[model samples]
Target chain A: MAHDRQPPPNPTSQSGLPLRAAYGIEDVPADHRASIGILPGEAPFHRGCFAQGYRTKPWRIFQLSGYGKPEDENERIKFLLKTGETGFLMEHDRSTADHLYNVDHPDVVARREDVGMTGAPMQSVRDTHLCLDGIPIETTYGHAGGAVVQHGPFALAAYWTVARRRGLDLASLPGTGQSDFFLTYLGCVTKQQVPTQAGLRLNADIIEFCGEHLPKWVPVSIAAYNGGDTGLNAYEELGALVANAIEYLDEIRRRGRMDITAAASRCGGVNFRTTMDIFEDAAKLRAARKMWHRLLTERYGVSDERALRLRIHVVTSGSKMTYQQPLNNIVRGTLMALTAVLGGAQSLGVSGYDEALSVPSEHAHQMSVRIQQILQHETNLAAVADPLGGSYYVESLTAELERRAWSFVDEVAAQGGFLATLDSGWLHARARANQIKEFADEQSGRRVVVGVTDFTDDVSPFVVDGFPGVNDAYDVALERLRAVRRERHEQGARKALVALEARCRGSANIMPAMMDALDQEVTLGEIGEVYRAVWGDWQTPELV
Target chain B: MTAGQRRILLVKTALDGHWRGLSVVAHALRDAGFHVIMGGMISGAEIVRAAVDEDVDLVGLNVGGHTLVVERVIGELRAARPQLPIFAGGVLPPSACRRLGELGVETYPPGSSLEAIVDAARRLTQVHAEPDAAPP
Candidate 1:
């Protein structure tokens, strides 16, 4: 049912901030005007991070790649790398990895056919090794597959153990472990997960361990992309992200072991999502950096310039990709990728054209890389950093976003903090409200999604049926789990698990024991058992 | 119209818990005056049991995984209750959609509007308002 009424004269940003037809110097807020002249690479880096943005270092072409067996995922990763992907992200099966269950778990067995539909099932370090078989660990920047909170230690330990096996120094290893709260608590909540408090402790332990040993590794990335894609608006995404960071930094400071600046620097490598709202999202990124700088200086009283500048990895919003005319998503991907470049992202992953249907096929994955390649090579879009910095409209919108975002941050803080809000389901309620509003907007014709609403008919001959990951993932994973249990030294495995359980029980770091456990072939389910026994499961807040 | 009331059982065939689509559809179904039972992430046996126990007129399976699992679930449901119509949604590829359609299940993949889904629910369950009943 299309709306017959005329549209309102004045429109607003996606976050509900009103916009004027024209903006001038008067429209730019006074406080923001002072920083308007500030250059990239300077303090409070709203403009950008590096003065010579892509010229000095082009944004890394990092794409999420994984599914099926470990070998199958490795093949896809190799394909992406050959097609000019600068970095690779390993994704683990949600059925196995997100829940920390082995292939034989009753829950997984019930859905055996769905085992590796989302990502590879790496139940043990051997499977992780197979996933990284030919990939170079020392030089290439890898994202070890631990997107879930409870799974982070095992994934990171597996990656590190593999590196050590290759005789690589832990200090020189560079990769990111995504133990993000937004993913764990809000976006894709697993059926069973450690409580938020336990998750915080695990993340702190990872950060501390990384600081002491794997100095180059990004201990944990705060992916607000999950929050945004799950339905938090632009301003709320920024505010909630900052709130999450505050929780991490405050915990680290309370421990009083590691220096806060290093902890802040570790937290700097954050991720955000760019949607079809190009200008607003680009403005959101700018506001994000500035808000991060202000948070560090104002709240924590830290002056390390390196720690103030937030590094961003933008993944174009997958929710924006329509499933109707799947080919149209390629253009959407390009536009969103351009926004990320305009926003001065350090790295970017374009959501595949078939995102609405399934994980990217080989062709769709290549198209994702090609879209970034075209932007980086053909258009010269990366020549100047923060290209949208000076325009009156963009500047005004950026300042407005920053002001509103800070206020939202204050609101979240007033409600006890990010994790508390998540535990209380307050954030989920906000996201659900936005989801309803957005859906209603589409239904009422206020927001017309092409192909879905307006252009319903398709004339193209090509059919996009989505990627069908290998059928044998479940069988192979089950065989490998049996092999690991049978071949590994049973006594050593039990001892390592006992040590890990002790570490989990006490206040000490759990990584060393975790590494030993993985090295001894302690399967994922056993570790999950230990966690369940010690910390217990988080009571997932109710959501419709 | 049914004599007493029409009910629909919504269940997830896999363990993935992203509920944005399911929530919208459930709200629309409730608004349209259907009894909506949310069966969160249940097995094929559990789904069949729930369908029989709740006496649902229709079954909506949120298929987020392999078609084989969904096919099996649909098979079990059909075996248990021959008359219960089934519809599916969530990340189903075109091939999977076609396969499910072959099994007599209407498929609403991503990008299907809430109105279309609600209309599908009504049509599938054959639940229409009585002239004397109050408006929704």
Candidate 2:
């Protein structure tokens, strides 16, 4: 199926650089002199997080694995773990999880088949328990799925409640809660969510709660991956992420609860996407650490090095993985993962080869891990961090990305900060514009995606229609929802719901009460009902 | 090239919020002298309401999730306004495309050309009649 198409005469990238014959010191720029000399452990960590690189600790092979019923998802997680995966990410069903709706919600019931297609249908603590069955939550690094803005507290509380039920201490848990605004507002706007302001408040509450109780937790990771996958380019992705961090940090400052350093540390565990634009995407990550260091030091006036050190988890771009000749996407996945590794990500999730077609098959997931393994072992690439550090094109691109991103950050700030832009649909417009440009570029043949825009035949016998997730997810979820309702202490559940409502109305942190709600077995939809009554829905901007 | 010249009704049959493909397609449609009314995460009833109220000649369904739900929307739209022409785009696989094609609804999956899409809009809306075809 491979077409031997000739490379274009002018193969220079968006940046006007000649296709090099591989030069050395002459390629290193003068202005970027200071940054080039800095080692991986030093300031402006463009090279990597630590000086020793993977020799100290190999990059965490973190695959985003979940789907179907809670028990099924749990089995998958254990499988990933057995395959040497370092972390577990619990993904909630988008229909229920993203909307904060339960299985019985009319909206969810309407598309019942779609339920748990993207993730496990975990609606309560019992479901969470079932999902975490036989897994040690205390030691293992985990991601409790709150991938939407509104569902953050419920997901975290549910996960924690299950841990608590297992006699694990909240203060000693090591995990993360992804109450990402980019996922909610930019990439996949939920049908109904609390307004951005309210969402921000909720994130702040989670941050404060995590800071006090779960010390080893990333409260809210501003997933620039969502923003990037939506349409934002490398620079825009960097800027928006920083601007998002500012929103959280500023909110913490206004609230005057925990130290700003502590909040920054909690917010520092961020995620970005690595696309097929290997050089630029790699530059984006290198530039990211520098920006984080600068933002914490120069802007916030924070001196804590730990707070300045940005921990990154990169998921290979799902959009880059094509639907056509799905097997070819393995090469795309390898290349994207290589970019992340070269960029020195602390953790990585290679989007499965069958990403465009469907959620990953078990084989696809293992292949994703294998790609990372091959890069880690077969190639001595991991030994040197930011190997492209001093090259004129890379350094210039890094600085240029940083400069442009700061401008975008200013634009975001001018629009009354990140949350405000989301509230007004301004950010969506920005992403939409870029998305249009991307499509137009492809249409004009300026962007050539092999096997898609050109060379569109597959000789391979293998055909991947996609792995259909468990069909029993809806039935199981419905049964579980009924079971939880039937079994839970009704009076306690009612009391918990009232307390949750009061907290929503009051100036109190919602997490403590949220945890209580989960303990009392107040269902996800009940909490959603309270949220609707108190904060009202976010007015989404018309992007499509 | 004036504003609100060619009317297009853009609706997502599924509640899935993966808006990247749809937004880009909608922009291209609008840029090609079309009025794009975003029917955000709408159901079949809402799609019918927008199509009837907006009086759009062409309906663009951004099918992010299952194609069956989209088929349901198409069925409802056909029942409400039999004359309306519909086209679909999103993460549809080849089989899904064939299914949509069987229903006379053109499918534009990922990697589809904006030019092709714009041309389809013109033909479906009867703004420009199909070449070599006699009037229906």
Candidate 3:
């Protein structure tokens, strides 16, 4: 099929944008031209964030690594760290962590084998402690796995509680929590969650709490990678991310607790997904920084440069890692990481080669880190920031993306903000539309995904059924749950539970009580019970 | 209608929310003129309930989890609606593919062409323009 399409005029352009043979600077819009001369580290940071680029600081080799039991996950984390992974991410199992449910929860009991298929199952503060065993949380940039909305408070509190148990000051903790609504509500919607309004309240509380304590923490990163993976194209991903930031900032402003600039700075450390459509995805990141600067300065009327500079973490698109010939995904990872660098990201995590089969194998995790290492050390690509900065195609695409994204942001605003759109299922519809279109393109051969739809032959010698993870995860989790209930101080647990319920009912930030609950040895399922009682379940919108 | 419209049952075997494959197939089957009922992440009992209640002409299963669970769903659906034709898709390895085929269900793993899927739908539903002839 690859040979059959030889003279097809490269069916799609390098940018995934339609192309003509050539063009002049005149074709660039007047609005675009005004910002043409803006350098990196300047206003409307369309070019890049740093003037020195990689020469000053290379992008961090931040890989997402976790699986099996807590100790097992910790061992894997330490292994990755030894492999020179600059930062570590704690991945919680979706069935337990994402929904804040314990393994004994009926929904989880139904899929026992899937308990730790995705990540480690942490059911209590003891499990959290086990996951953090031997890891230096005080220095390294840690991503405590709160990637879902409903689970954020529990996950963050558990990590902080572990830090406190280690005699580390809460004010000096240097980890970030990902209480991303996009992941929970949109991308991979769980069977249940707290209402969107309740989620907003929790996120705002996290932001406000982090502002006063844990000065080094990025409260909640708005990961557009979820949106993109769920099928939002480049422009839509950019638009929805900005819209999502607006929801956080607006909620904080309404609370009237923290400065809007501080909130903007905290929320500005966002994430995006980079695909093989290198130039377009790179332009998307470039456009992301510019759009963030404009949105903060114009909408919030804030002039703090720190608040305006958008810092991004890019995870190479996992969906783009084809399952056909698994080894090819390594090349795909490298290319996507290059696109991220071209777009000038602050940090990056390359998707594992065996992504379609399962989570990353230890070797696959090593390759992911090695991919970033090669790019940082050998490619000379990082020596200059936004190397595609002044190119007419790139600059033009970046400006066009910003224009389109802002319009999308406006559309979200008109619908009464991001949370409103999510509640109303309007955003899901948009993502569904892009998803359908992309599938149609691949189906009709207008776009070709090299290994799967085209280039069918494979020469690989090794078979990849992917990592099955440890079989003992379920057994260990059950034993731990019993141990916690059997061993812990029952009186303190009951008292903390009551306090948690009271805080949930009242207007106070739930984090302090949440920390207390963790310290008193409250389990995840118990906390989930309080959440369900107070907030109730969100009515999920059906896409069908 | 010229005759009774053909009804097809579509369901996901796992709670994983990746819906690109299901949505595309659903759209293509609908385009090819069949009533496609989506049973999202339902249990085996629920799958059987929908298959019987809808009186579906064909059943399509989207699987991303254990083959054992999918096998259970298939057995229940077959016991409930013995005459209904069945097909499966999504991340099915060669071993799983042969096993599902042994159960008398056609399998379309990733990279199955939409044209081929539409053809399978038409054949499974007996909706060809010339129904007197055998399927290709």
Name the best candidate (by lDDT). Answer: 1
TM-score of each: 0.96, 0.93, 0.94
Q: Report the C-alpha lDDT of model 3 over A237-283, residue by residue, as the tens digit.
A: 99999899888898899999999998899888999999878878998
* Rank ordering of all candidates by DockQ, starting from the highest: 1, 2, 3
Score each candidate by Cα lDDT. Answer: 0.90, 0.85, 0.85
Candidate 2's TM-score on the B chain: 0.88
Chain A of model 1 scored by TM-score: 0.98
Q: Provide the TM-score of chain B versus the true chain B for each model in turn.
A: 0.88, 0.88, 0.88
**Model 3 vs. true fold: TM:** 0.94
Candidate 3 lDDT by residue in tens digits, B30-97: 87888889887777777888877776788899887666667887877766666668899986766777
Tens-place lDDT digits, model 1, residues A1-544: 3434456566778878898888899999988888888888887888998888789999999999999999999999999999999999999998888888898999899999999898999999898889998998788999997999999999999999999988999999989999989998998888889999999999999999999999899999999999998889999999999999999999999999899999999889999999998899999999899899999999898898888889999999999999888899999999999999999999999999999988899999999999999999999897888888888999998999888888889999888999899999999889888988898888877777888877677898988888988899999999989999999999999999999999999999999999999899999999999999999999888777
Residue by residue across B1-136, what tens digits does model 1's lDDT show? Answer: 3466689899889878777788778877877788889888888988988888887788999988999999999988877776678999998988998899899999999878888888898788784232221111
Off by over 4 Å in 1: A1-8, B1-5, B127-136
Which regions of candidate 3 fall more than 4 Å away from where they truly are? A6-16, B1-3, B75-86, B93-105, B124-136
For candidate 3, the TM-score of chain A alone versus the native chain A is: 0.98
Q: Per-residue lDDT tens digits of candidate 2, residues A1-544?
A: 3355566667754322344645455555555666788888888787777888888878888888788999989999999989878888988888888887898888877677777778888888888988999998888999998989899999999999898888888888998889998999999988898998899999999999999999998898889999999988888899999999998999899999889999998899999999887888888999899999999998788898777889999999999998878888999999999999888898999999888867789999999989989999999987776788777777766777888889989999899888888878888888887787777767767678888888896798886767777788989899989998899999999999999899989988999999999999888889889999999888888766
> How many clashing pairs in candidate 2?
0
Which candidate number has the best TM-score?
A: 1
The TM-score between candidate 2 and the true structure equals: 0.93
